[model samples]
Target chain A: MSDKLPRLEPAGLDGWIVRLFNDIDEANLSWLAALANRCRTAFGDALVDIVPSYTTLLITFDPLSLSPAEARDRLMVLLDDLEPDTSGVAGGQVHELPTWYDPSVGPDLERVAGQTGLTIEEVIQVHSGKSYRVFALGFAPGFAFMGLTDPGLDCPRLDTPRQRVPVGSVAIAARQTAAYPAATPGGWNLLGRTCARLFDRQREDLSLLKVGDEVRFVPVSREEFERQGGDITPLEERP
Target chain B: MTDTAIGVRVLRAGPLALLQDAGRFGVRHLGVTQGGPADLYSWAWANALAGNRWGAASLEVTVGGLELVAEKDLAFAIAGADLGATLDQRPVPLWERVVWKEGQVLRFASPVSGLRAYLSVRGGFAAEPVMGSVACVMREQLGGFDGLGSKLQTGDQLTVHPAGPSNNTATQQAPSGVRPDFSLEPVLSLLPGAQIAEFSGQSLYDAFNARWKVDERADRMGVRLTGPRLDCRVRSLISEGINLGSVQVPPDGQPIALLNDRQTIGGYPRLGALTPLSASRLAQCKPGQEVRLKATGSGAALQEYRAFRARIEDWV
Candidate 1:
């Protein structure tokens, strides 16, 4: 890591954006997560929220309590004594999630296979072969946007968005893949369904995936999926 | 049970009625949008007149179709748009606290002036909190009267736990000078944002100089403004969490002023953001109404907000 200082810019009147790096990468993500931790520790109950994205950390505060300049000055002071963020030191919880990749469950599996000129089994092997890192969570609750998928499996979003994508849908868009926390209108290319429920408000920790965690998708059989209480994947294929 | 549960019973429910507090905060990482009252100015005033501190939950009535039959004698106040409200068949003026007796009917007909009206009880509407906010977000299916994001329905009762002593009358009313007139053109105060420099000079000039009309395509999510094309250098930016009153300009040049119920993260480049108070006024504007954007400093905006907050509560 270099000794470069993060540049602070005004996001709005009451908020400020800390630009840690110019692009999204593993190092920048680690740095952003570190800065985010510092801000969280510093702001405590005074801040409204601090949102971390690819290369920027936006800090929004209550106008009545703290002014933007005041928040900025505090961050600047923290920056002076900050240490280089070692990416995997803080968070590296690896999540092994199971996915049912049957044709019925993953409608686009065949299409993705045809596009890559690889067999369905080959695509599954490449996808679950290595652990993918969790870059960020946005769009929906527990919707972790992970990156650097196998180049062969990289694909663009559907030309038109699907009005309704089912819950627990494991899908890919560009080099990124995510599991839909809830059913919503999405444009991602669907590949499979997962038994893992990403979000449950009743739980103490509402989201299973957090920023800086690692994820791996394990392909499971229809019988195994059904045995795990997944109703979407039927035992027998429809004739 | 009846002795402990003193609440007002519902007679009629307007087009859309919901209970809202300040807003949900510190939860955007979960992709939870901040849910709160669309018209904040009115919501705050209503709370103040009722003698409750700020951030209290209040009823937000849109386009005025709500009616309430008081089951318990209560002190309440109404603010925001003149929605043709009446108490027991007599016209009840807005921006003032009115005493209510048991069995008195509080009915709202239609919009005489504004799109939404705020009504606050002496205490505040009682609702189970979800994710730390009682503000209702129907899209998320969380936080409301039943702890689920359901709009106010006919026969739904509103429970209020008194914050102060149950008084027969509230002597305070919004001063005449402080009351906003919804009929005039809205001059929204904009604090130019990060994307302000990316916009073409001509586009920036037109954004402030030209009069823009509020399009019919408006909701708690955002209000679309129809005006001259606002050309920007960048096609899109990385998606970031949006705050209340963030104004994003799309490729079409028209700007959408995002409100309280907006998505947690968005990719569109924002020309700037409206002050919280300006957003409150914009919420009251009807479709096709003309509005102009004015640039203001962030410090001035903070000061203005502090002054407004001081008016309702005992703040030094």
Candidate 2:
């Protein structure tokens, strides 16, 4: 019943926060995806941008063209008739990332294994064992926040974020998992590395992953990882 | 390559200098930030005095130490922070157009008044666009002189796009009223946001009445304000899209004003957001500079924004 309802709150001068649900989960994301699509179609050029996250969508509009009152009225109309896609097929795209769960690149592999009381091989199996849904993208360009990792692989973020997380490092924070699109300071638990270029300006599509997409990490050989352009340099040794 | 022959060459790249345009839009869903000039008012004035339209690429020089040599005869203008700029050992005036003869040295020393200055040539700087904008975002590694989101470097040859027919806007001076006095402590206008009710009355009173100092950990990304630790009932929320001037409050109660290069979304609870011009004014403040925030309504804020836009659109 909560998934069917939505509330709109004003943000600043020209922003509107469409609070769909209070919690983060697969249902919230699906509802947000449906709402995002509708907002784009309904608002058109008047909408500057619609930022979709786990449970809310922040809609910014062009104040010159559309007044807040008018935008609010239109948004209410859309909300009144909003129908979230109950069908499972609305989960958007699915992509598989070939991952290397090795200690050479993933320096935290042993730490995570030790914490979870699982062997290195069992950690890898638990991590690459299931599909994860992308809850949102933030923190950096092309960074996908995928989530709901198995309970065994759950881990807390570092007390202090690393000075530099190697590009393409596959990491997990709590139940969420992501790969560093570009080398940046990060705090997630490093589980492995990926060859996939998550964000590339050279490519036709800038970001490889999008909100609402499903991602599955598949374990790959070290040789295959290097062949696919994955960085094999040890994390600690990298500058 | 040949077209860039008539341009400015970086002789000495300062601590931070980057190319910025209006900003990237319609790409926040990909987690990309809107990278643009931190001080829009100054950047616009510089571009206008150079006879370029809005959204033209200009150089944003922070804390000043940048040195450049003109490759050929060029018309340029400098605005925003004075930065004690000198041309060939003579003082280069601010808020007005000036000529740069071939091989003449142009340099910016330490800040005399403001923290950042805008440098604009007649034709505007040219850089390959990334994600529909030439605004350099070093964090995202997109849009700069190299189109790879790099800051200005020594030996970098900044290419200037060819100017259109000389117009009235060129050789014009910025109105004195529009040029901000960067030396003075600024009172910023804020439009209170959704979570304003969650904060205690005392915190809200302190947020407005207290003099907040800018923290040393400030950059293009955001500026953290050190003041009364704001006590709020809600500590966090589902991450939402952050605007140019979102004033987010972390658990520590210190508020951070998100700026041009901030992350697209944040989970910290926000008290409100600063108006655009107020945010621009806040950007010019040095670390430890005192500032005050005044709550204002959306109607008044929009009116002020439109007036500024109209002034730029229709120059006297």
Each candidate's chain B TM-score?
A: 0.95, 0.97
> Any idea what lDDT model 2 has?
0.88
Worst 10 residues of 1 chain B by lDDT: B162-171
What does candidate 2's lDDT look like per residue over B27-72, in tens digits? Answer: 9999999999999988988988888888889999999999999998
- Per TM-score, the best of the predicted structures is 2
Across B1-316, the per-residue lDDT of candidate 1 in tens digits comes to: 1223456888888689988999888788777778899998889888888777888889999999899988888878899888899999999977777888989999999999989999998778887788888999887777888877899999898888755664424357777777888988889999888778889999999999999999999999899999899999876877666777889998888999999888877778888789999999999988999999999888999899888877766520
For candidate 1, give the docking quality class from DockQ: acceptable
Location of the lowest summed lDDT over 10 successive residues in candidate 1 chain A: A230-239
Give a tens-digit lDDT track for model 2, residues A58-155: 89988777766778888888888777755532547888999998998898999999999999999999889899888889999999999889988889
Model 1 TM-score, 2 decimals: 0.93
Q: What local lDDT does model 1 show for residue B176?
A: 76
